[model samples]
Target: MWGIEAGSVAQDTASGQYAGLAPSIDSWFLSQSASTASVSKMTAAREAGAVPMVAWSPEGNLTEIKNGQKDAQIISMAKSLAAYGHPFYFRPFAEFNTNWETYSLGRSGNTPQALYGAWRRVFRIFRQYTGSKSLFVWTVGYSGSISPLKTAWPGSDYVNYVGIDAYDWCTSSSWCPGDQYRYKTMLGALRQFDGGRPAILAETATGLQTADKGKWLGAALRTAQADGIRALVWFDEIVPNSNQPDWRLASPSSAQASIQAALKQPNVASPKYRDITTLESYAVSASWAKAIR
Candidate 1:
């Protein structure tokens, strides 16, 4: 299915455009630190007929989560989701293989074992409190090292979907602008570790480094479809940092035209989304929930 991480932009603008092209739209929620769950965001997405996907970052110590110091806070968030009574995609501590996140192995005093313990603790807590209403997604940054990626896995039992966050930023003098890569080339290696689980392009965007974003978008969609990727969620936002190029897709641009054309393809449009109820079945299944215990 097609979706977007609206970032700071209004969800209506991002979702409305996609809804015009596809039968269903997916909305993303990114929570930084230990903020309370935003039930209203989920409600707004559902009201607009979009499925909500949330990425929750603790932004604090990973050891606290593993040691149960954050149980109350985490459980409170899970309860709010359960009360909503609908299935939603839940990803915690995303990009853990990179140095940017607090829970990542590159952080001081953190290790692969520490990340695994923290993830399992959070996963088990949510599974206990929310039942099958939450679909756990394990996401890693596309730029992370392959060795760290293998070591940081929380195991297949705790994850429902394997996701990768990648972006195509043509070229910039500040960073390696010429280091751009195609969709399949960036994702091919990671997909091998998916363990037969469905995969998602959880977060992605292409910068205007190239004059024609449309061609870039078309190529990306074609690659994703050919690789059997289950979904792609565009990160539709402008990075506030001055050094970063705006990643938002603008109207009257070739990139926008390419998106419109690519989304019209049968393989990309009108997704047969899995019912949220399927989460409940997975939650209670021996194969899926065994590790949670």
Candidate 2:
């Protein structure tokens, strides 16, 4: 699936519409509370012909969740999603091996056992309500060596898809003083550790500083296809005052052209291309009429 995690369905769909590409999956975040209010976003995505992929962060102690403190919240989410009645993707505690996440295995005294327990608990509850209609995605931030990713797996039975968030955060030696930035290599590693499940690039983008960014984008997509990735979602945001590099193709027009070329390939799925084109056209025409007035 060719997908994007961005501001809105219109925005996300527009990202690829010019190329006759629309997201097969529209990825978004569910806050620490795991609010079902975001169902509105999911509704919009579905209306536009895409499945919703929620990256949920159930903040606070993982052990507490394992011990059932968050059972109410989990059940609420599961029932709400089940009532929605359309298939979607649930990705909870993404990047669980990264130090930055509050629920990370080694952070705040969280153990691998706690992670496992918490995940299984959530998975079991969701299954009770959603059944096999929805899929549980387990995603990790790629760590080049000696990573806790495999150790943190909740098990094959609990997870339907395995994914990695691989970013090219380094272009200058100053940012990556150790020269450790590996975009393509990380994509290569995803297939090996997917636990025999379908693989996805959950979040990815090259830094703005990289030379020939357009070429890199094209090559990355081709690499993902070659690696047997079932889905790839571009992290196409330009956050204000953030440490992350600008990965939006909107800023540099040429990068969009390159992505367009890559997306033209038959393997890249864009189920909502017509809907996106209509939306884009309406917006443009509305703007033109306002200008003439």
Candidate 3:
């Protein structure tokens, strides 16, 4: 009754957790493998309307899944995966701006050019594979150290949705005078890239008690509505994982209630994710996104 990530999917299959969990994975992620047996299982799971989410470790050489590492490798693998007959979410190198261990920009001297090359090739391949809404997600760190858009921005044409990953980015340095600080910056950046496209908070954590999560979330909703951002993906740390600790850990019920309330507000738009097809038309021209200043 849950979406299985790569780490847990292995054991789940071995222990026959699939028997208990298969139904829950409906419309969510399920681990797929290079093996036909696993693929068949995944297919069966998906045929039931469950989304057998597959991870494309393109940046990781289709084996390692690095952050900003591969270009030709990603394109090549994308083709192979498409031929395989099962592609879900189509999500690849997610956290580029943030300094995550799995994948990051600063690694192997990842430059803007390298990122662009990889992005363009991936976009082209994905377009060729699925010509409609297939869902390709490009996620960013909510509190990116590299501002000045150019350093942080990637090809918008390849990205159907804009996702921001923010973890306790409310430190004195990261935050400004008050709520106005993060709100203005996030809204402005998202609006520029959005261009009428759907956007999501992607991953955010109000884990920290000091930060006024309620106020921050409320103001963000109001500002995004005014600016017209699409949706908000709350990063609640249900338990310890790769995303917790470093981000906001919501404690007070008020913080939880406030953020929940704001997101539920009907007037505000919901975050719209990208499918496999129609990425090109929805995405911003590489040239235009690079113009970020």
Candidate 4:
């Protein structure tokens, strides 16, 4: 549940003030892709000149640790980026609706076009390095209303999939605290924009539980089944030394039951929704090309 995709490992020192990080942190961050430890490293970097100052970019800047680890996640990204090149899944600072991380929070003067351009730069770099159909995903945070859709969207060539980062909150309020992000509910909303490729829960908070976590879990599954979202990823923050609960969800043993139960029901597949039957469809373009499977 906890994974770290380290790129160019850097020493956490501005001249020996001991930036609160451990030597291992420096040892790991400073490792390069070429080093024996980084023999298999890969990094997701944010191409400079892409996003505009009008927008915000946080987690979006996946520092291409020149010495990125050559593991599953890192290698996968490297393979995709080096092969398909630019215009890949440029989902930078998605889910602006949620104030979780600096990457995705609020927007003031930036237009979607400018945001789109920034993202395109990433994909373009990937394309330049990879190939076509790099499969870039533009996802939003979840468990609440989607406000970014109201803004401008990137051009057709730049984006491939539209997704959201939904968590399991009892009711649709804020983060998925007590009530886990019921899979069913999240899937239900995903169905609204079904055009197919694959509607995804780009990021999800799980493992932690409140009183009604189980209920939320049950409802989430049902919702996903009814809606047809194709994929989901549980973002269990497991970075060493960072005890901040913001990105970290509960990993307590008590919540294992709920986590196990959710994992068991994996086939919450969708056929991609088409047609603007609902008002929500109109807002979120229900098209196959818009969906990145």
Where in model 3 is the C-alpha error above 4 Å?
A: 1-57, 61-91, 101-103, 145-156, 169-183, 186-198, 208-216, 238-264, 268-293
lDDT of 1 by residue, 1-293 (tens): 66776652255445446434422335556565554677776766665555677888555577777788888888778787777777778888888877877777767677777788888888998899887768888887888766766566778888888777888765432554433244454466665665777677788777664445655666676677667667677776766757766776663253555656656555543223323333234322312211110
lDDT of each: 0.65, 0.70, 0.43, 0.37
- Segments of candidate 4 deviating more than 4 angstroms: 1-80, 83-90, 96-109, 143-150, 155-157, 169-197, 206-215, 238-250, 266-293
**Highest lDDT, which number?**
2
Ranking of predictions according to lDDT: 2, 1, 3, 4
Question: Where is model 4 poorest over a 10-residue stretch in terms of lDDT?
Answer: 46-55
Q: What does the lDDT come to for candidate 3?
A: 0.43
RMSD (Å) of each candidate, 1 decimal: 6.2, 8.4, 9.7, 13.8
lDDT of model 2, residue 138: 81
Q: Candidate 1's error at 26, in angstroms?
A: 3.4
- Candidate closer to the true structure by lDDT (higher is better), 1 or 2: 2
- In model 2, how large is the Cα lDDT of residue 286? 17
Tens-digit lDDT track for model 2 on 145-230? 32555566688888888778888775443454322234345545544555577677888876755345556666677777676666
lDDT of 4 by residue, 96-178 (tens): 44555433324343334445554555555545545553455666655544444434345455555556665542233245444
What lDDT would candidate 2 get against the real structure? 0.70
